[model samples]
Target: MTVYDNCHLGHARAMMAFDILARYLRFQNYKVNFIRNITDIDDKIIERANENKETIDALTGRTIASMQEDFAMLGLELPTHEPRATDHIEGMIKMIGTLIDKGHAYHSAGGDVFFAVRTFPEYGKLSNKNIDDLNPGSRIAEDESKKDPLDFVLWKSAKPNEPSWDSPWGPGRPGWHIECSVMSLENLGKHFDIHGGGPDLLFPHHENEIAQSECASDHKFANYWMHSGLLKINGEKMSKSLGNFAMLKDLFVSYHPEVIRYYLISSHYKSSLNFDSDSLDQARSALTRLYQAASLVPLQESDLHEDSVKGFIDSMNDDLNTPEALSILFGLAKSINSTQDAQDQSMYASTMKELGKVLGLLNDSSEAFLQYGADLTDEEISQKIEERNQARNNKDFLKADQIRDELVSQGILLDDSSDGTSWKKS
Candidate 1:
């Protein structure tokens, strides 16, 4: 994740998708070495720091802390090695030198180094675009220093008051593309099992990484690439102009983090997710049903691996079909609801949670999760229930009804059985 600004739902979706993948893989007994890189030094990071009147280190440090806090709240797994781009500049310089030596890169007259797209025949292999048909940003535009519009900067010439590192191409920091190329090769070796990011990275960012890494190392960069689908806002692309752009911090004020996660994984990872208030409300209702069912069960181990659990594993094995996996879990919840047998409900709930662990959810105590956003504390709720009971015992039907209605307004539902009264979040 980049450290230029606060993390938003788009960031959360991509992160949660990958985190779920890692958890499922580990659940299957696979050793997962997950590496989520931090792009600490970027053009936007610099611009934002300057705008905030803070030093670059101060800006990035604060943002990284905020990112960590947000991810942890969403229950994302920490990466095995979280390498910052700034920490891998020396490796970037070494790789740039190698590319230059191999005639795939050149230093321009402006004291900048650029990768020659013409020199690498597989320049557009990842994006599957013709070199002539490509339309990159102004950074790759035809210029005096850049021989072709397709050529991209490996190292930039130092500008006034900008960060720089001493290199053969003079004192300038690495460009955006070179950071991942060098960092991935340095940590995961020249070749790795998988490379992943959001679908937006599949274009110039990933294409450039491919060209530069392969040309420099003379080998395949990654065996496979996995990109999660893009997220949208109510059938429209997210933009500040749309007035629907949201940040995770802002959304967390209204919805539970686990609700957000459940909503994100409700669709296939490769399918576009449309975010709206209604979708989140539905997600909350669905999760509430699971917790309500679990409340009837006593905690126990699920070594039996019931049919629903097998179905969940099947769904997940089919390319992480989370929507179907969730459906299977809901099936178990259905069994718990339909049956009066205590042992059956306990078995189903236990299996449901065993599957939920793969999705990083449903482990919370039933009362805690069910009453997650309730206005009253547990003690307060219990006191209210007792007051209502006393009112009923005194034959004050009006007083008892009033208390019950007030608690319902605060999302505390009451169940009056022959024995006594019990309360739960609505």
Candidate 2:
């Protein structure tokens, strides 16, 4: 996780998706040593610290603390090893030295070290792009110090008044790409089972890491790559510029973190999740329904339905197909809800909660989930009012009226006029 800023919804999506995956693996009795790296030192961190007029440590420390708080609140299981980049600088420097010793990398006259991309015959294999295609018509402006335009920086040259470390290539820091290779190598060895990240990293960041690591370490790396899809607002990418940027902190104020997790994992992990109030609405409804089933029968030991258990496992085994797994969970819930047979209800409820643990859902008591989960915070009510106004402005009357009805169902009456809508709770 980058320590430059607050973790947004996108960050939460990737982290939660992996968190459930790790849970399932452990449930399946696999020894999973999950290592999530913290990038404390980077160009972004430096720039952000300078902008905030704070020391790098101060900025990163605060951000890391906040990230931990947010993760804990979301009930994300802690990683087995959380290695910070600054803590592994020596590993990075040693790897850089190894790359330089090989014919795969070179030192620039400008005191920077760069990976010689042309030397690596399989440079574009991971990204599936031809080198000729990437550099077609001088598309990318080459850095004069770089041997080739595609050759990324391994160790950037130190500048005045910036953070620096004593390296063979003068005093400088490791580039973003080199940090991951070093951290992963240090934690998981030359070849690990899985390397996971957001889809955006596939191109340059991941592709560069592959080239640098393989060339440095006998052409070996992670065996499998898992890329999570993006989280967007409405249908477009969430950005501050797009006026749709959201922070997880703000969302937590409105909805429970578990609800957010449910919303995030409702769709398949590999598919993009379009987040909005409507999506959250569905997530809450579904989670409550599951909780409702668990509430139907007393919590006790009962034989789980073999078919439902097998179905859940099958769906999850199929590349974490959470949507199918959720349907199976709902099927159990439906059995409990539709039946008056106490023994059958107990059996289904036991199975529902048992399977739900793998996905980090259905832990809450039915009474609490039904009551607290339905209640909106004051901030959430205000936010809902704003969304309703937005819907009205766009002439989406159906959606506008729906938001109003949802708020009203919460026992909050709205007074509307030219002055705008104001809410009063009775």
Q: Per-residue lDDT of 263-371 in model 2, one digit per residue for the tens?
A: 8888888899888778766776667678766766889999999999999999999999988998999999899889889998888989999998898887777654554
Off by over 4 Å in 1: 137-142, 239-243, 376-383, 417-426
Query: Candidate 2: lDDT over CA atoms?
Result: 0.84
lDDT of 1 by residue, 1-426 (tens): 779788888888788889999999899999988888999998889999999999999999999999999999898988999999999998999999999999999999888899998998877887788887777664355567787768888998889989999998789998999999887888889889889889888988998999999888889999988899878987876644456678888877666788888998999988888887688889989998888888887887645446787788899999999999999888888998999987777788888888888898897787677667676888898888888789888999899899999998878888878867776666
CA shift of 378, model 1, Å = 4.2
Off by more than 4 A, model 2: 136-141, 239-243, 373-426
Candidate 1 achieves a global lDDT of 0.86
Top candidate, metric lDDT = 1
Residue pairs of candidate 1 with colliding backbone atoms = none
Superposed on all Cα atoms, model 2 deviates from the true structure by an RMSD in Å of: 8.4
